[model samples]
Target: MTKIVVFDSGLGSLSIIKAIQKISKSEIIYFADQENYPYGKKSQAQLSKIIQNSIMLIEEKFFPDFIVVASNTPSLMLNVTTKKIFDVKPPLQDAKKKSKTKQIGILATKSAINSKGLTQYIKENNFSKKFNILKINGSELVDLVESGKFISNKKYCNKIIKKVLEHRLSQNNIDVVTLSSTHLPFLKSLLKKQYPKINFIDPADIIATKIYLKIKNKQSKKNSLKIFVTGDIKKFQTKLNKIGIKKKVNSLSS
Candidate 1:
């Protein structure tokens, strides 16, 4: 089996897990560093250290064939250096290439917005001149997703949607909105149901598709899944159970 490791800060990465499971028979190890949750508020030096330590920890523990950094806040740091073990195929890259309109919106966390990584990725892709990029900090929206109620909570989603999109959705000029955070993809259906006018790009889908393409031919191997967290296993299980994840999930300390 093609063993894979998924690294994230919280339940947000579960969205990534959902996508990968659809097309791959490979085993997956989900490592949730809840001890370092809300990666948005961290500094560049701190993120650098976190990413490095995470890579080392996963390598020492899981030793999987691939590592997917499903957290957008952390993935923002992927571009600055050439870290070979893990990479994020963000939809923003694909959206910039495929979208027909010049006006585009990137909705992510405050950390992602402030990270020079966004600017670096944009310029690295030569998206500096032609496209008008609108960056929005959807930090509160992320909290809603992490709260484990966004799916069942419509009124809350609607209110947050308005707070997030009403002003921008009113404009006819924008064509695509990239949900840069992995957490944001879970709310795409709700967003689409409300505003059918603009297209939403999710990095989770893009990353999952890429992973499938890489491991699709390796089905001859057996598949397995294990989840790890730096915090309470019961709490993680409770959150996952709310979303129908009833399987056994162990804590890092376990």
Candidate 2:
């Protein structure tokens, strides 16, 4: 069976995992590093260390064929990807192509929004000088998903979404917004409801397609999943239950 390990600071990993499962029958090991919740708040040095340690631990523990760093915060802030390791980045090229207004928005965590790497990445991917890229800090929205408020409280989620996004998106005339953080996709429905004209793009499917193409021939007949959390197993399990993930969540060993 093709074994793949996917992980992020908290519930954000579920978005990427769900996308991967849709196309491939690879055995997935999902690690929710709750102890390091909100990788968006970490400083560049802090995030570098946290991501390095997490990747090392995941490699030592699972020895999977591929490892996905499912959070855009660390993915954009640091150089973490290798041959087998994959990191999520904002899909600026896709946004540019789809954007009729030539104004594209990147809804990412605070760190990613402010990261020089993100700016560089945009410059590298964007071939046209005509397209304008707006970076919106979506850390609060990411918190909603990690804390299970996105599923539990739609009213509150809408409030936070408006408070965080409405003004900038409306002012910039951005027709397309990239859900740069894995956690942000959970709010897609609400975001669309709020801003009907905006096209929210999720990079998960693109990432999943890349993985599927890489291991399509070796995929197992059955899709199996194992979930683990690094902190508060009971609380994390409760959150998972609310989202209809009944699979047992094991405590990740230190």
Candidate 3:
């Protein structure tokens, strides 16, 4: 069996894991650094160091065939740092060339948008000229999901969706809206319903497909999905249940 690890700051990455499992039979490991809750608020240096350390820990414990940095903040900002620390290319990089219109609009956390990492990458790759980078922070929505408040307020949800759409339209008529934050995946239906004209890009598919290919090619070992958190275990489990993940969860400290 092949082993793959998927991680994010919290339950958001579950969306990625779910997609991957649908495509492959590899054992999966899902880790949520819930103690850190939101990686978006951290500075690039801080996020890079924390994520590097976590990767090292995961490697020592599971030695997964491949690791997916499912958090947008880390994926966009600490990608290079993580690669240097772990000596692996992130799966999302494989999907970059396939991007149409070259214009990428990212919906992520405030920290990710402010880090300018994705913007810098696009510019450095010369995709900046062709790629119009539009960014919107949806951290509040993450909170809503985690707190179980999203379902309670339809008006609030619509307001947020409208705001995100407005940002996309004002930025450059984006061809691709990258759901940069793991939490944004939970908003897929709403996004599609609100803005059917724009194609929403969730890196989960690309990342999951890459992992499946690697496992099929016998490039990585197989591992089981293990979840860890640093917050209320019951609350975390409730959120996971809400998202349809019924696996047992574990709790950890920083």
Candidate 4:
């Protein structure tokens, strides 16, 4: 069984890990740098350094066959640098040729949306002309989910859905809404309910598929998973159980 590591800023990456486990047989290791719960607010230099150090640590201990950066902030901030440093590529870069509409809207944290790294990436890739990037701050949804408020707060959930739809509509000709934050997938049903006409793209599926493809050609011993977080273990465990992950959960000191 091949080993794969999934790293996120918080519990949001659980969505991605769930998707991956559904489709693949690989052993998974899930790590949440919850002490730094919001990578979005960090500077590019800070993000780069932290991500490099994290990757180095993961590599040393897990020796994963593939590592998935499942956080949108880190994905956008460190994709290029991580690839260069680790000699690994992200699946988003290799996603199928997008539709000609060239319009892309992102639903991420405010910080990620405001990042110079993302802006430069769009500009450098010439996506500015073909793609119109729109960002929606969905960090609140993360808090809600983590707090176990998603199922109970129907009105609030609807409000968020409405806002996301409105934001997407504001960007004319947007054909794709990038679920930039890992947490956004939990709201997929609500998104479709409010805006069935719009296409919502979750990078997790793409990332998982890419990992599957990479490991397809390699042979390795089977592995299991250990989930670590720098937060309330009982709370984290409850959230994981809510999402159907019953793995052993560990708490890390901040």
Candidate 5:
């Protein structure tokens, strides 16, 4: 079977894992680096070290075919992509195509929003001058999902979503918004309900397709997933249970 490793700071990795399962039969090892939760708040230098260490540790311990850094903050704010390494990035092209007003919003974490890397990424995409790219800080919403509040406390999540995105999206008349953070996808249904007219784009399926295409020829057997966390296993397991992920979460010892 094709062995793959997918990881992020917290529960966000589940979004990518779920998507990958839909299209490919691969053995997956999911690492939740909750010890370094909120990658958004770190400096680029700090995040670079954390991501590099995590990547080295995961590779050393798991020795999977490839590894996925599933967080948008590190993906967009640092030079972390390689042949067998994949990172999640906002689907700006898709947003541009879907947007009638040409004002597309990228809902990502704080560090990603403020990073020069993200700005350069947009520029590299060669979006026309008519296209307006709005970067919104969604760290609070990411926290909601990481803390298990998105599932346990809908009303509160709704409030934070409105507080963080509603005004900015409405003011700019952004017809399309990309859920840039993997954690943000957990709030998609709520976001759609609150902003009915705006089209929310999720990159999970795109990411999944990319991974599936790469490993599909390997002839994997039944799909399987093993989870690990760098933080409290008991607490993280409880959070996972709330989201219906009943798999055993092992402690990352590397």
Candidate 6:
């Protein structure tokens, strides 16, 4: 059995896990490092060490064939041998590949915009020669998704998306709106409602597809899936339930 670890700061990785479940028959052990919630604010050095330490600790107890860093912030900051979604900046690449316009819009957390992985991806891709990228720090969007505030207040969510799309990329003639942050994909519907003309790129889907190709031959659905969280189990469990995940959430900090 292929044992894989899905690591994220909060429930954002659940989006990735859902995609994995549909594609591979690997036993999944998901860990949400709620103790270090909102990884976007942490320094790169701090995030690197934190992620390195977490992986080391996880390896001591459970050995997986590979690890999947599903969150965008940590995925960019950490230099691990794991199979990370943002390793090649797939979101940015997809944005450039699909759009014919000279301008593209990227919505990401504060850390992702500053991370070497993203910065380097942009610098090396010759994106500037082809398209002008307009980046907005959607760190507030990440917080809202983590707290389930968007689901609870749809009106406010719509308002937030409108403000950035209308103001930040108003004159850029954005052909694609890339949700560079994992959490931002959850707001895809709202974003579409506000700006139906622009295409929205979800990195989670690209990541999921890549993972499927990696394990497609060894796939089975009978593998076990476990979820662990560092914060309130009930709240986390509620989220799992809504996502049609019946698995019980165990306390990770204990």
Clashes of each: 1, 0, 7, 2, 0, 0
Q: Cα RMSD for candidate 3? A: 3.8
- Candidate 6 deviant stretches above 4 angstroms: 82-90, 221-223, 238-246
lDDT for each residue of candidate 4 in 93-151, tens digit (9 for 90 to 100): 42224535655566677667777656775566554354455656766766666555666
Report the C-alpha lDDT of model 2 over 154-249, residue by residue, as the tens digit: 999999999998789878989999999999898999999999999999999999999998899999998899999898999999999989999999
Ranking by TM-score: 5, 2, 6, 1, 3, 4
As a whole number from 0 to 100, the lDDT of residue 160 in candidate 3 is: 72
lDDT of 6 by residue, 139-229 (tens): 8888778878777888887777677568776678787987877777788888888888889887776766777787778765576788888
In candidate 1, what are the lDDT values of residues 63-181, reduced to their tens digit? 77888887777778654223334555346667777668777888888888888888877777777576888877888778777777686787988898888778875663777888877
Off by over 4 Å in 3: 80-104, 128-131, 150-152, 167-172, 217-224
The 0-to-1 C-alpha lDDT of every candidate, in the order given, reads 0.76, 0.90, 0.68, 0.67, 0.91, 0.75
In Å, residue 47's CA in model 6 sits off its true spot by 0.4
Error of 3 at 89 (Å): 11
Error of 1 at 57 (Å): 1.3
Measured by TM-score, how close is model 6 to the native structure?
0.89
- Answer with 5 or 6, whichever has the higher lDDT: 5
Arrange candidates by lDDT, highest first: which order? 5, 2, 1, 6, 3, 4
Q: Where does the lowest 10-residue lDDT sum fall in candidate 5? A: 212-221
Candidate 1 has its poorest 10 consecutive residues by lDDT at 80-89
Compose the digit string of candidate 3's lDDT tens values, residues 1-254: 66667777787777787887777777777778877777778888888788877888778877776777777777677654332122112223433554576655667788877876766755565543655566667777677666655566756887877865675565675666767777777777777787776677676777666666666765324335778766678878887787667878887653
Query: Which TM-score value belongs to model 5?
Result: 0.98
Tell me each candidate's TM-score: 0.89, 0.98, 0.81, 0.81, 0.98, 0.89
